[model samples]
Target: MSNNDIKFIHWFRSASPYIRVHKGKTFVIHMDDSVIGSDNFTGLVHDLALLNSLEIRLVLVFSTRHSIESRLNDHADVSHYHNGIRITDSETMEVIKDAAGKLRVEIEAALSVGLGNTPMLNAKVIISSGNYVRAKPMGVVDGVDYLYTGTVRSIETETINKQLDANEIVLIPPLGYSITGDVFNLQATALTRDVATKLGADKIIYLSSVDGISDQSGKLIKEMIVTEAEKYLLENKIPDAAEQQLLSHAVYACKKGIDRVHVINSSLDGGLIQELFSRDGVGTMISSTSFDELRQATVDDISGILELIVPLEKSGVLVERSREKLELEIENFTVMLRDDVIIGCGALYLYEKEMTAEVACLVIHGDYKNSGRGEQIYSVLEQRARENSIDSIFVLTTQAEHWFRELGFDEISVDELPVEKKELYNFKRNSKIFIKKLN
Candidate 1:
């Protein structure tokens, strides 16, 4: 087979797990009006159609900021705002309705394409849109009347759910209707977060201009949980109000019961699919448990610990360890868990008199081995050793010598081990010893 063909097979296999996991899951995607105007918008539509074909329930929430602003620029009146919210007067409300309606139709046409020139070839996507969201007036916040600007009051989930179950993509505009028969302009981010929360969606994805939140050094902050995200805003001043607002909504969503929120650069080709299918996604992921912890193992984790290591033991990569021995030495182990499931683990066996520790059993789950979980487990054990006043860390391995060497470990003689450990070393296994000196 050709090399390119082989690579395709490998990538397809790698993507299979994500496809299985995401099928039948509900995801709310927020698209900025800026993205709609980009050259890559057609590609984004194709990707969304692929998601539809894969049986993913989709709720598309679209923002009209750029669209409405473009329309307002044609008239003589300047746009007015209070606290970053557009003050939608009678004329501005007319512009809002026209722009929203125009974008909705264009999007629907894009989703309905089946001319065989695109990925939608012969596939039909049914989409629904309407008054599924109700709103109430902002009631003059800070004494500035938000005339036609409103906040979400209640979501009509049953109707949306019914449409979703019927395999129809639900399209939501950034507007809501009230009981008094008036259309109100809505903040797209707030509407998206609220709808996802009310529907108990599995994810909220924002297709944005920026890749994601970045640190002062311009490195992408790939993952942040609710608490950490809140701290970042306080510690680092984000000069861009748009980015700050987007991240604020992400944190709010995580706190309000949504576990996953993704912000990706929609301008990148296939970015939406890349974020969903890849192990290390192409954008920022604000999760509820981004730093899901490493804690000292307890008696309860014995079974999970064994489950993680037994395969390695069977493959002769690790020396056999027994349940009784593990139970007795459980205090030396630390486990990494995500959503309460053990994903990685390592142990720190301290040599008190020698002021050293042996880092052992750094096992990560089979599917997640290369995603830095093992490295994280190793770091946690190293910190544990330092806290215990150990000046060096060591490991004995039959299969992971190169892996350790890459992480700053140096091959060392077995005789260089702490006296007690040297005496108990299993000579028959002929394991290699590697050591790292702590600073």
Candidate 2:
């Protein structure tokens, strides 16, 4: 096979886990009017259709900001605002309604496209839109009458879920209806958050012009917890107004129990698929909790641990461990979990009488072996040893002796090992011993 074909097969296999994880889960995607005219908009639509084919329920909340601005400019009207929110007067509300309606139809058409040799060829997608969201006017604030600008009051979550249950992609425009027969302009960022929260969606994705959130150095921040997202917003670190608003709402969504919120550049081809399927996504991910957790392993983590170590055991790099043995020593194991997948693990077998512990089964998934994660796990085990009043730790390795030495362990003879460990050592393996003395 050609190199490209091999790469495709590898990527497809790698993405299988994510595919299984996302199936049947709800995701709310937000797109502004700006994306409609972008060169890669069709590519974005293709990715959406692909996701739909993967059995992921999708909800699209789209805004009309650019369209509204164009309409107002055409009519020689200027927009008014209060606290960064558009003040939708009678005329402005008319423009908003027209823009929102036009954009909704455009988006629906884009999603429905199917042609020969196109990604959406033979792809059938049903788009649903309605008065599933209710709103109330923002009313007067600081003695300024905000006529039609509004906030989401409630969402028809049950009805929306019913449509999703039927395998339809629910399309929501950035306009809400009121009880008094009124159409109100809504802020799309807050609207997306509210929709995801109400639906209990698994993810909220913002397709923006920016690639993702960045730090002061202009480096793209791959991930952040909710608190970190809030801090970035509070510090006014995000220079783009659109990104700032998305981050603010992302924090709100996380606080409301949504697990993950992604912000990716809409112009990038296949960006949605790349962000959702890849292990290291190409965009920013703000999560409710730490995405990578280092902690003591429980019995529940046995299967993941086995998936990591079983290959190494076959290669003779590490000793083989039985399921029952791991379960009995589960408390002694510390694992590095990324999105709940164990990527690295190590075990500390304590010997109280010897005032030392044996660090064993040090293994890292091959994909992440060079990322310094192994060192982090080893450090945690060393700290664990210190906490238990152990003066030193030892590791026996047939292949990783140099790695242990770099961590400050010195080469040691097997006779230097504790009596019990020496007695249990496998003569056939003949692994080198290394010990680190904790200060």
Candidate 3:
């Protein structure tokens, strides 16, 4: 009915695929104590409830850092840390337990919300917590005993799985109890990574304090592989405690066989939903798989490239060219592939005399049309054109006019094209010309 409504419909339809992919998959999400106290806590709770309603099995892990600090402050004790870990003496363990117990109740209460005319309205979300984690004392190290500070010994996967199968969201706290009747303060990030690895979770997400992991310039990284994450952690001096913990544990989780680990800022309303449901999620994703592989197209890629564009050619949206012509121009093309499949491709034909390049034959597989592949291919060609001292880039298209226009291209008459290209222009095709200034 309206532009906004149409956009919403498109977004909703696009989200359905992700929803389907998430269905029945187990995800372990971790949040720090500050998340429970944030202004957007209620909204975060609603997102968790929505995920449950979507039939996604969830395991939520949380820490009581700020709350524990508050308790320690009130009890007249100064906190101590060894190698970035809190030295949890018996006295500190009391503050941890008190803070964690209160938080567990608050989290459960928040998730139990049921109201009218709201996202949580009519949403029935069941929460379950347990001693699902077994831990042992982090004994003396370097002559400094981490008394009452525990490391995860093992995770009760079967019990956690049973609760998840029963449609219950498992909320695990950072404190763990030993068989010897001792409650120990556990490092939340360590526990989250251990639990996710043990359960073989489909995904593990950390709701961070920062707006995901950012570079020195404060730009958030969209995705990275485990190796790249390791290098990043070594390179970036992240200032936020929560952000550092999320990154360190994300690298650990991905290396330990967890395929995906996401980090998003919990302060944003509905941030979790945006992180999970959207492509190029509103967070940094540390993944096991390489996101894409872009390289120059060779003769071997001819068949794959042809298959990629045959449909568009048949539909008269693309100008059909013979195999011999493609062979001659193969060196001008670049392809972005995933898992060895040529998902997208484009060609850059340079007119040296005019210092202009023609970008043509751009096509992304139907499934990947809206997945940013086309823009990626364009960027590659644009960069290549710049490297060759090209002054401008142009495209002639019977379709995708609006797509190019949206990316800062200006509609231009064909007469402005390079003289050589002008001579070859096909009036029968009547393709619209669009030009992008490179300088």
Candidate 4:
């Protein structure tokens, strides 16, 4: 496809549950050491690069509690999972250097090459170990002595912000230090949370192996709030440790005033794009409540509404309502506009003391279909009905039965129509009768 097509797709995917956009916002991505060799890494880098192209500031911190040498000595058997965190033993720690350091360099090189090729990639990307992290070693708990594990004591927020302001991506290795000059291994997820909180980032996204957040039937949960997530977690239905971490981070981000958080599967092609731009995102979105209102259609909105319904009218899916008719009833029309662009429009025709009004000409732009705009327009008409003290609303649609059904409209027989409407119905084009009760 062309560049414009790609951009349109990008915008569509931005509203998806799996894709998230922190436009003019700061974000921190915790890249677990295990993700280094995973198939998802290349796509992850590309997605991050795409974000950079959009001028959204971000930081990527790689964390590994085990050194590469340890993994090699252990014959690469040091398994890592759960919230993208790797469990490390003494043998694992010995080989972690191979994964964390050497592997980091390779990843950095790959990102550099990729960025260099893209005209949009101009941000400075810095790669460093936990050299700047002030850490405290973990203490023994229960019957297990946590080997080289350490938690973040402090992150140099000033340094991070300075880099971010300069349009740089900061990459941190999972190595931390104490005031006494002791270095320790750290969990990638823990460090990511600490740094993101410290930086007051807009979001913190975790790309995992599983398909985003799922319901009891394993279907993805599209949108949710922290309270809902907390309830889900309390019921022990979140399913896995990774999901638990995603929920924890989402709650933390919400509590800290971060706009939103997302957890998605990295393996899916274009998963990031699907999550960030599409209305029904691929993964789950934990966000604050959103309330939408409809306003009076403006003069500038006429052309857009006409364009939206023109195709349907041509195909006989909708009746051909002339622009002259629209101009006359302009005051009775309501429109849904996003960024001043009309995505949907509908009209209300009043009758004197009839206790009902006709809700006609509902149309949503093709690109914005399935975005609930039609329902929003219908809601506006219902509110108008209440204002006018009308008890019910009527519609005549040749198609769109399911759409009307979703709005609580019922299929009423032609005989149910009032005398005046029935007379008009007989003289006018063929259409199905639909009625919605306001009371």
List the RMSD of every prediction in angstroms: 7.0, 3.8, 9.3, 7.0
List lDDT for all candidates, in order: 0.87, 0.89, 0.86, 0.70
lDDT of 2 at 371: 80
Please give, for residues 161-267, the per-residue lDDT of candidate 1 as tens digits.
99999989999999999999988899998899999999999899999878887877778888888788898888765556766787889988898888899989888
Clashes of each: 0, 0, 0, 33
How close is every model to the real structure, measured as TM-score?
0.73, 0.83, 0.70, 0.63
Off by over 4 Å in 4: 1-22, 38-40, 65-98, 114-132, 140-148, 215-223, 288-377, 380-439
Candidate with the greatest lDDT versus the true structure:
2
Quality of model 4 by C-alpha lDDT = 0.70
Query: Model 1 off-target regions past 4 Å?
Result: 291-362, 365-397, 401-439
State the lDDT of candidate 2 residue by residue for 218-274, as single tens digits.
899999999999999888898877678788899999999999999998888888898
Clashing pairs in 2: none
Q: Rank the candidates by lDDT, best first.
A: 2, 1, 3, 4
Give the alpha carbon lDDT tens digit for every residue of 138-252 in model 4: 7555544565666788888888777777676777777777898666678766677777778888777766656768767777887777788778888887776767776777777
lDDT of 3 at 90: 77
Screening candidate 1 with a backbone cut-off below 3 angstroms (N, C-alpha, C), the clashing residue pairs are none
